[model samples]
Target: MTKQQLFDDIEADEDWLTGLSTDIWENPEVALQEHDAAEALGDALREEGFSVEFGVAGIDTAFVARYGDEGPVVGTMGEFDALPGMSQAATAEPEPIEEGGPGHGCGHNLFGVGSLAGAIAVKRAIERGDVEGSVVYLGTPAEEVGAGKVYMIQDGAFDGLDAVVSWHPGWTNAPNKGSCLAVDTFSVRFEGESAHAAAAPEAGRSALDGVQLLGNGIEFMREHVADPVRIHYVVTDGGQAANVVPAEASMEVMVRAPDRAAVEAVSDRVRDAAEGAALMSGTEVDVTKTSGMYGVLPNHTLGDTILANMEAADFPLSEEQEAFAADLKETLGSPSYADVPADRRDEAAEAAMFTEPLDAPDEGTTGSYSTDSGDVSWTVPLGRFRAATWPAGTPAHSWQAVAAGKDLGTAGMLFAGKVVAGSLYDLLTENELLEEATAEFEERKGDREYESPLPADADPYELTDR
Candidate 1:
């Protein structure tokens, strides 16, 4: 089948796809607990005649679905986890579907659904004997907390793949061929003596004081690190009340660097600072490494191919979709919306298919954000692109992102599904393309092997200390 015919097939199944998106969105499963969503998509893949494997990486929510038996295994990565406390309803105005519940703030609901649609479409193409290579759908979980793919890689889930294609839902459409920062998430805990503020102020040691001192030390260290190194933190617990000298306090720190070694070096310095704070405050300190990810390795060969497919694909928007996006654009201030690339913005009072690359990465740029996908890029030749799902400049992890996720967001997801399907089709049919991608992967991975940022025995869900 031709690309257009494949796209038409996906369009015909739009309602089913939309239903899948809505169901997953409304359910709002987080990380390793995405059993329902994974089972639902697994069943869909199985119904389409793909051999499905559940719990491949020792994580119940993670799975792999495969079809065809031959060379050049093409993988499409899927994520179904949602963010915490972002449960928004599918309405024009902001409304929480469940008060203080999880929501698809990052659009992973669309992310997984679109990938499933692409994998199923590719399965159909293979069933017709039009494609000769194998297709695998990777149901990766815990992306919100950044350890799903890490665990999968450790479990050898991504082995034997020729190339992996993934897409993210965002404000603009472009093939990303750059590096994302590597990140490490950890926490520092301080222990001190609790005492009455007025009667035993001198006798009491302040854990909160240690936290503040550590934060100050980190701020001073920030100027000495690499230009791209980012160190940020929030006091998870800084004593219950101001009157009593608290016995316990903790601060969560997230350190991001352009590369792994840089992140490691900076993280070590941060740990030392925490220790220093403890020594000065006469309090005990414990530093716990929670989770981390590697920097993205750009695969120009796969990237160029996906970019060509994205440019060639037809991404038409409906009138209602255009109006919805326009309204969302209005909700954000003029300055914020103006930050969207001019080419992506609606011109002539209509939502047109974005046909050109943006001048700068849009606010919701995927590579601009740190993710474990950066780690996956190191394992195999992975290419990620963004499709225009929400209105221009819709901040990710927000109610606006959740609102657009229902409609226009879903359409953009379907558009990305087509791109993914088409790209996989090219990979399966064209041996030279796979070779090129593999060659690029080899070049980028020279002398370096895939080492997960998470420890060998680390459980992705054990983030109580994060």
Candidate 2:
């Protein structure tokens, strides 16, 4: 079938995909706890005749669904987890459906459904004998907090995949071979003697003092670290009352650097700071590494291929959709992008769906944030693109993002589905594209092998109830 026909297949499944996205957006579950979202996507794939594997990689919310007999296995990724404490109603005004609850602040509600739409369209082509090879849909979870894909890789869930394609929600449709930082998440807890503040303040060792020292050390260490090496932490526990000397306190810290080695170096320094703080406060500190993900190794060949498909399958926003975006833009007021030109701020405020020019691939330029998908890119020659899901200047992990993901985001989501399915069609139909992408992957990866950063006995749901 023609590429347009393949894109049409994705459009054909728009209603079903919309329903899926809406259901996920409304119910929004936090990372690694997306039971309903997982089941919904899995059941839809099963109904489409894909062989389903439930609870893959020992992750209860993770799954793998497949279609077609044999050839090169092309994998498509789907993420369904939401963020914690980001509840917001889908309206122009800023308000939560339920305040302080989970919500799709990152637009992952559309992410999961849109990706499945791509996979389903590809499966249809495979079934019609128009496309050769297999299509596998990977249901990845906990991308916001824990790197679930890292565990899945350790469990050998991605073995035998020829290549993979994925999409993310973004404010613009810029597709390039962009890289992101390597990140590590760890929890630090301190224990000390407790006492009544008024009775005998000197008799008690304060764990809160340890936490304060740790924070101070971390702040000082940040100045010595290289640029773009970010360190963030939150004091999860402290003294319950002013009259009490706390016996226990805990902090969760995340560190990010341009590469894995850099991340390791900075993390080591942070750990030393924690230890020094513990020493000074007369407290014992326990540090546990929760998860870490590698920097993205962008494949130029794969990126170009996806960009071509995106350009070919240009899905413009309808007038009504644009109006929806405009109304949302009114509520958004001033727009903000990390690197937008000052002159473009006003233009970016209006919600619109248009493809940005393909940027020249820069190896040195990496994103400020990190994602679990970075691990998947390291494991395989993976190519990903961002669809314009929110109004211009609307950042991810915000009320605006959650509101946009319902209606305005659906258009971008469908367009993304088409771009993904169209790209898969090209990859499945043309063997040279895969070879080129694989060759690029080899050249880019060099001698670097993917190593999971989780401890040997690490549990996927250690931070949350499974």
Candidate 3:
């Protein structure tokens, strides 16, 4: 079948896909705890005639589904975890369905379902003898806090893939040729002697003092580091009471940079600061590296192919959907477009939903956010794009984003599914596109080998739960 026919087959399953997206939206689960979402997606994949494997990489919520036996293997990832404390109902105003609970502020409810639609559509084409290749859908969990894909990659779960394709929900329709910040996470704890403040203050070496000192050292170090570096922390534990000098305290710190080498460099300095803090406060410090992710390695060849499909396809929104988007835009008055180019800022602010696609940015530009998908990009020739799933100027991890995720986000999800399915069809039917992408991948990764930064004993559940 033609690419358009493959897209049509995806549209035919729109009802099922949309229903699944709604189910995930209504019951949002946080990182590494997505039992319902995993079960639903696994059942659907089985019904679609794909072989389902659960508990991939020893993570209970992770899984992989496969179809076709031979030829080139292409895969995509679906993240089902939601952000904590983002519980908002589907309305223009802020109203949480469950106060202080989990919600799909990042539009992952649509993300997993959308990617599944693409995989299922490709499976149909393969089953019909229209294509001779394999399609794999990875049910990736705990993207918000745990970096589930990193652990899966460490276990060789992503091996044997020719190329990987995926998308994220965003406020614009564009292919992301830009890179993302590589990040390293750490948890630092201090141990000291506790003593009554008024009775014998000299007997205590305050652990709380070490926590505060570490924060100060990090703030000072920020100015000395490069402009792209980010170091932030939160004090998770201080003490039991104000009168007692704290015996134990802990904080979680994250360091980010433009690439892996920079992250490693800055991370070393941060660890030294932790040790110095303990020395100054007379406390013993224990630092643990919880997780780390590589920056995305963009493949321009695949990006251009997805952009071509996005341009050739149609994304029509109904009057009701447009009105809803307008209401949400009104709520976020004068949204900021500082990230966009100065010349395009006005054009970007005009639309409540961007229907037209933007070309990928120049290579070497880095985005501010981090994701486990970055690790996957380094492992395989990966292509990523963003669809306008939320209202224009709506920031992710906010109540407004959760509000628009039910209906507005579904439209963007279907649009992304079409783009992905069509792109995969091209990759399987035309050999030159994959060849060019592979060549680009090899050239970009010259003399470098991918290595997981996460420690061997690091546990996703223990790291995120604490």
Clash pairs, candidate 2, are none
CA lDDT of 319 in candidate 1?
84
What is the lDDT, from 0 to 100, of the residue 278 in candidate 3?
A: 99
Each candidate's lDDT (Cα)?
0.82, 0.84, 0.88
Assess the local accuracy of residue 349 in candidate 1 as a C-alpha lDDT between 0 and 100: 26
> What total of clashing residue pairs does each candidate reach?
0, 0, 0
lDDT of 1 at 187: 70
Kindly list the per-residue Cα lDDT of model 1 for residues 1-466, writing each as its tens digit.
6777778878888999989988888788877788889998898888889888887767888898999898778989989988889988766677897889988888998999999888888888888888787899999998887767888889988889888999888777777776777899987899999999888999899999999999999989978987878999999998888889998999999999877888999988999999999999989999877788997787777777777777767776788887777777666664244434455445512443333444234322324458888888988889887888877667788898888887778878888888899889889888898898888888878988878777788766676336
TM-score of 3: 0.97
The window of 10 residues in a row where model 2 has the poorest summed lDDT is: 354-363
User: TM-scores across all candidates?
Assistant: 0.92, 0.95, 0.97
Best by TM-score: 3
Candidate 2 per-residue C-alpha lDDT over 192-260 given as tens digits, one digit per residue, 9 for 90 to 100: 999999999998888999999999999988889889899999999997998999999988899998889
Ranking of all candidate structures by their TM-score, best first = 3, 2, 1
Model 3, total clashes: 0
lDDT string, candidate 3, 157-218, tens digits: 79988998999998878888989899999989999999998899999999999999999999
Best by lDDT: 3
